[model samples]
Target: MTAKAHADAILNLLRTAPGTPLTVLDGSVPNGTVAPYVLVYFADEDPELPDSRPLDGQSQRYVVRAYVHSVAGNGAMARAVGDRVRSALLDAVPTVAGRVCWPIRREEGRPPERDESTGTVVMDRVDVYRLESVPA
Candidate 1:
């Protein structure tokens, strides 16, 4: 799947998840807006070395970032949102465009912190997936 497709899959997954409080954005939130939300976007992709075994499909390292924010300036809420995101995405092999995206995994996550400029608490998490599809 393409990067856009990957991001869309993630956004859709989070949007439909149960009991998630914040709004989910494809990339960025609107300027001058200060609502609790999470931004999902494609970060980067890298190619993995081809394996020797047959059926060793092309592997790619795809990075997807989730940015959680809360206007209440409550770090706990931000962290809770991040935790929900992590629970939904970790080890998930979500299908995209009718194809199974395999071996998706969470890489790392950051704790909530205050954004000095906006005064909103924010939490960031990064996930890495090994997309078996050939890189475009």
Candidate 2:
């Protein structure tokens, strides 16, 4: 997916949940010859609260994951593409910092891949979330 599309997906998830914590389980590039391009958009709501008071309605952080696919199953160029993707996600998070709440974690987006054959794992970029927010 394009960078704009990826950002849009994240925004959609955040808007949908309003106030919640969400996690992106995984992301990848599909292997195929079709417009099999799929955007894996997701959102999770954090139900945890600082206290268990009746007045505590709680706030949540919404999350999303986007995936892009190249025809190659896995290759150097693909790795580069994936790396750029992860970097983009990481860079995007800081844009939302300090706007919602103080002392928050940076939203995280990481590229983690591995090949058991060679015992090699590649994590291109990682961004952790701060304050249950979207990069405004």
Candidate 3:
């Protein structure tokens, strides 16, 4: 599947998952978006290795970010949201249109950090995942 399809699948999965925070279909959070929200977006595609073949399946990377506003400046709430996202996505298979996708694998993770650019006390955790797929 294409990268956009992979991202859409991830977004849909998170949006429908029980106990998951409100998920943003696009990566950008609206100006007044509430905290404890999730952002899902397509990051990058894996480059084929030297030994890879033309018929080899495609691998795409997607990023999920969990954000929470906390007055205490602690990232506990953000971490909790991140945990929910991981529980719902790690090693989970997402349905991609016109493709058969393998179980998703986490490529990297960033612990919760404070973001000050928005002029509010916000914490965010980032998780990156890779999805492999072949045309159905």
Give the Cα lDDT of each candidate. 0.57, 0.35, 0.64
Prediction 3 TM-score vs. true = 0.76
TM-score of 2: 0.37
- Which model is ahead, 1 or 3, in terms of lDDT? 3
| Model 1 regions more than 4 Å off | 52-72, 119-136
lDDT of 1 by residue, 35-72 (tens): 45676556655445455223655444344444333233
Point out where model 3 deviates above 4 Å. Answer: 50-52, 55-73
lDDT of 3 at 134: 57
The digit string of per-residue lDDT tens for model 2 on 79-116 reads 54434333334334333332332232334444434334
Give TM per candidate: 0.69, 0.37, 0.76
Tell me which residue pairs clash in candidate 1.
Answer: none
Clashes of 1: 0
Best by lDDT: 3
Report the candidate with higher TM-score, 1 versus 2: 1
lDDT of 2 at 100: 35
Worst 10 residues of 3 by lDDT: 63-72
Per-residue accuracy of model 3 over 13-36 as CA lDDT, tens digit each: 677777634555465767777677
**Residue 27, candidate 3: C-alpha displacement in angstroms:** 1.6
Q: What does candidate 1 score on TM?
A: 0.69
